[model samples]
Target: MIIPDAESIAQARSIVLAALSEAHAKHAGRGFDPYEFGADVSPLVNAYAALTILEKEEPSELAEESSPED
Candidate 1:
């Protein structure tokens, strides 16, 4: 898979936060309290952090050699 750049990463974060916010709003309207469930969202947070780390690391030589010239 092609690793995303900084801007792409930011856009993804925005999208994820927006989706989460929307879901929260929907549930709140139905009297859902997140604190009551004590649900941990760490998995999703950790996955996103891992993606950032992958983006920061140098691209694989194979990826570099295979990508078309700009």
Candidate 2:
């Protein structure tokens, strides 16, 4: 499995938020596309949710990677 780090998860959240904002802007004073918004934001939401669950279960696993000593 390709596990994402906290930075990556944050970036994903930013991307989803941006996309949702854009969608809202485009649909302002009009009907929005639920399908499009759902498609754009679903992955980020799912990823974040999954990360949250994982964090609760194994918080320490998210610590910084350790380097080998010389």
Candidate 3:
């Protein structure tokens, strides 16, 4: 799992929204099914939710310090 910074989180949200929009368009044209969109996005949504919670709980210093550079 990647620990996303604020920028990465924003990018991920954008990507997810874009994917959902594309899925909707494809379904409208009968190229893909609506149900498949939910299946495809469920994991990304779940992971994002988990990451949001984790970010809130994480200590700021833990992110600021680098273990390898220690």
Q: Pick the candidate with the highest lDDT.
A: 3
Q: Which lDDT tens digits does candidate 3 get at residues 1-70?
A: 3456766766776776677677677766876665887787787677667656655655565466434563
Predict model 2's lDDT versus the native. Answer: 0.62
Candidate 2 residue 16 C-alpha distance from true site, Å: 0.3
RMSD of each: 6.2, 6.5, 4.7
Q: With candidate 3 superimposed using the best TM-score fit, by how many Å does residue 64's alpha carbon deviate from the native? A: 12
| RMSD in angstroms between candidate 1 and the native structure over all alpha carbons | 6.2
Name the candidate, 1 or 2, with the larger TM-score value. Answer: 1
Backbone clashes in model 2, listed as residue pairs: none
lDDT of each: 0.65, 0.62, 0.66
lDDT accuracy of residue 24 in candidate 1: 67
Candidate 3 versus truth, CA RMSD in Å, comes to: 4.7
**Cα lDDT tens digits for candidate 1, 2-66:** 65676887787777666657666776778887764225344446656775675676667537856
Q: Rank the candidates by lDDT, best first.
A: 3, 1, 2
Runs off by more than 4 Å, candidate 3: 31-34, 47-70
